[model samples]
Target: MDDKDLELLRILEENSRLSAQEIGSMTNLIPAEVEARIHALEESRIIRKYTTVINWEKAGNGEVSAIIELKVSPERDFGYDRIAERLSRFRQVRTLRLITGTYDLQLMVSGKNVQEVSRFVSEHVAPMDRIRETATHIVMKSYKENGNTLFEQQEAERLPYSF
Candidate 1:
């Protein structure tokens, strides 16, 4: 809300692991003040959750990820909210959003492999009452995510090929 609060949020966004004292030092606030502001942010839901963005490939737990666009027939009673909630309940669903676009809903899904993702769409998502169609786009590589670069400099570098 205030300048201090905004600055505090920026600091936390960079590194959530920073201690209250460290954050206070960077933001020019006392440790207690930093703690109070952070608590308020949490209560207000401005800071939903502190999370670590892991590079799954490097960790050797890489999962197949896809961005699926859905064109669904809205229910008469609750419209898209009801359907969105249903999709949210699935474990494969990572992110779901309703936007003003060609599709009614956009979903980011993860699975053990391509087959698993295809199966999820065919067996689970396609079976949903209102779902009319789905277009899946699998993520081949991610250069960056959540403002963090997935690949390091050395890994990105390659020798120039002379023709």
Candidate 2:
């Protein structure tokens, strides 16, 4: 990707709602050109889904969040992919990662309460054929969850000090 594409991505990452004209203004490109480049980016799957970052606490839905580490039976006889696919379908699962170390998979889960989360792990996750053991850590509060892309745009748009 060229510098223009990188700039476009930066803008879109901050706010996907920005119009092609608005993006064009920021990048000094014509609206049509901006539109075409955006189209190309989308078609190439470079720009995936546009999403909103909601503060669950402010929304009054924040109850609890947990990180679960799962140790699964080795995939020599059984396939881990199938298990991962099934785990991914759960509503409470925010993110799942297959990683190295003592654990095979790491899962980020959010629920209304501890009971709800425990039920999900015991009933849904534990019952799986390949799962050997699981460890869970409840999050009290997040110091930093995900970094804000908008901050970069704000910095870029900041005016220089006038002497």
Over 4 Å off in model 1, which ranges?
154-163
Displacement of residue 32 (Cα, Å) in model 2 is: 1.7
lDDT of 2 by residue, 87-142 (tens): 99999999999999999999999899999999999999988988999999998766
Residue pairs with colliding backbones in model 1 are none
TM-score of each: 0.88, 0.79
| Model 2: residue 41 alpha-carbon error in angstroms | 2.2
lDDT tens digits by residue: candidate 1, 1-163: 9999999999999899999999988988999999999999999999999999988988888699999999999988888999999999999999999977889999999999999999999999988998999999999988898899998867566789998
- Model 2 backbone overlap count: 0
Model 2 C-alpha RMSD vs. true structure (Å) is: 5.9
> Any idea what lDDT model 2 has?
0.87
Model 2: clashing residue pairs?
none
